[model samples]
Target chain A: SQQGEEDPQALSIQEGENATMNCSYKTSINNLQWYRQNSGRGLVHLILIRSNEREKHSGRLRVTLDTSKKSSSLLITASRAADTASYFCATEGETSGSRLTFGEGTQLTVNP
Target chain B: EPEVTQTPSHQVTQMGQEVILRCVPISNHLYFYWYRQILGQKVEFLVSFYNNEISEKSEIFDDQFSVERPDGSNFTLKIRSTKLEDSAMYFCASNRLARGYEQYFGPGTRLTVT
Candidate 1:
């Protein structure tokens, strides 16, 4: 399987604290994407970092990619209670098209 | 502000019964995909469809599994003779082009196979 794995499978933090999730994959990738899923809801696209890019940010979410290590990280800064969700990292393999292999995901809980 | 939409948010069926999960992807996107999560596990890719045919699929998408566009706006995943292990959340997703970056997903359909 080309799927990657995520670390810190579950996390808990107080509101306003920062939450960071890490993902590691085995193969060379064209791009990596981050997604957030609220309980029992659809996944919302968070960010996408191409292989050539090292870092990207959107609103309170920051994503970093290091191709040499085959790893990526997502940082949610100043997280609110509503930020609680399961975050996954999906990789688009160098040769694959249209299908993305997803990580197990990090379950984040922000307590108010 | 368009998002993917799925019908029959939850389904309960007996083993050996066939069930079809329906999805309406974002209007302009051309590539469509189906993924399933066996509760507590990683989301696994089932299949990808484009230009009225399958572009790619994973091992999990066996002979019992099939996908179709059927029309301009709807994409569907059909499970034939579902087994107990088939119980999972099925998610429908789409992106603008191949390589499938930045996909938009529909609220998954929870399938309970009894």
Candidate 2:
């Protein structure tokens, strides 16, 4: 299994607070992506960080990657109720192709 | 913005029956993939198709499973013999040829095998 493992399987935060989720994988990867899924819906791509890059940002989402540690973290700043969703970290294997291996995911809940 | 679309958001079938899940990937995209989530489990990759051939597949994509792009617009996953354990939410995804890293997923088909 090339899948990653996300820490803090679940998280809850106030609307104005920040929420952080971490993922650790065992294999080398070309790129890591973060996705959000609202209840029963398809995943929405949030951000992508390449192995050559350490960090990337999109809107209020901040993603940091540490290839040496084989770990990545996603931070949602000033989270809103709408930010409550299941977050997954997917990795593109170093070999080739667009296939992705996904983590167990972190279920986040932001209270308004 | 274009996105992948799946048909029959929900399908119910009995064990031993065959099921076909359909998807229409974003037009102009060159790569297509199938993934499934068994309720609370992690998303598992099934297979990937490119250039009209299977580019890659996981162990889960065994003899019971097969994929085809029968037409120019539709991609399909066929389960030869559905089992109760086959119940899952199947997602279809596509990525542009120029950007293979970012994939767009369809809403998914909730397959219920009883």
Candidate 3:
């Protein structure tokens, strides 16, 4: 299974602080994406970093991918209470045809 | 902004019964997919559909699970027989040909098999 695995199962941070979550996968990938799920609902796509790209940013969210290490990290800067949600990292396998495999997500809580 | 949409947000059925989850992907999207997540578990890929046929499927998409695009707009996943373990949140997703790697997911249907 070329599943991505997220580290730090849970985290709690005060509003305005930064929260970082890491993900590691076993195989090469075409692209890595970050998603946010609120209250166990459907996932909302946040950012996508292609294999050639090392870093990508959208608003307060930044994602860094290191293919050499088969790892990726998502950083939420100046997190507000609205940023509190489970963050997931999904990978589109290099050999697979556009199938996104998700990892166990990191539950983030922002205290206001 | 168009996104994937699914019908029957929640379903409760008895074990061994048949249930079909319906989805209508974004109008212009071509690729479609079905995925499920058991509670507290990672989201798992079930199947991917393209050109009116299945292109890829995971181990979890067994004989009991099947997907179909009956027309140009609707995509469906049918469970021939629901097992107690099949209870999970099922998500439908789709993407356009230009952006095949970036999928937009539906709200999902929560299946509770008794």
In angstroms, the error of model 2 at B20 is 0.7
Cα lDDT of model 1 by residue, A28-64, tens digit: 8999999999987888999999999999999999999
Model 1, which residues run further than 4 Å from truth? none
True contacts kept of 1: 0.89
Give the per-residue lDDT of model 2 (tens digit) for A13-97: 9999999999999888989999999988899999889999999989999999999999999999999999999999999878756
Tens-place lDDT per residue, model 1, B1-114, is: 999999889999999999999999999999999999998888888999989999899889999999988888999999999999999999999998878368888999999999
- The lDDT per prediction is 0.92, 0.92, 0.92
* DockQ-derived CAPRI band for the predicted complex in model 1: high
Instruction: Name the regions of candidate 3 deviating beyond 4 angstroms.
Output: B98-100
TM-scores, one per candidate: 0.97, 0.97, 0.97
Residue B62 displacement (Å), model 2: 1.1
Instruction: Let me know the TM-score candidate 1 reaches against the reference structure.
Output: 0.97
Scored by TM against the true chain B, the candidates give: 0.97, 0.96, 0.96
lDDT of 3 at B11: 97
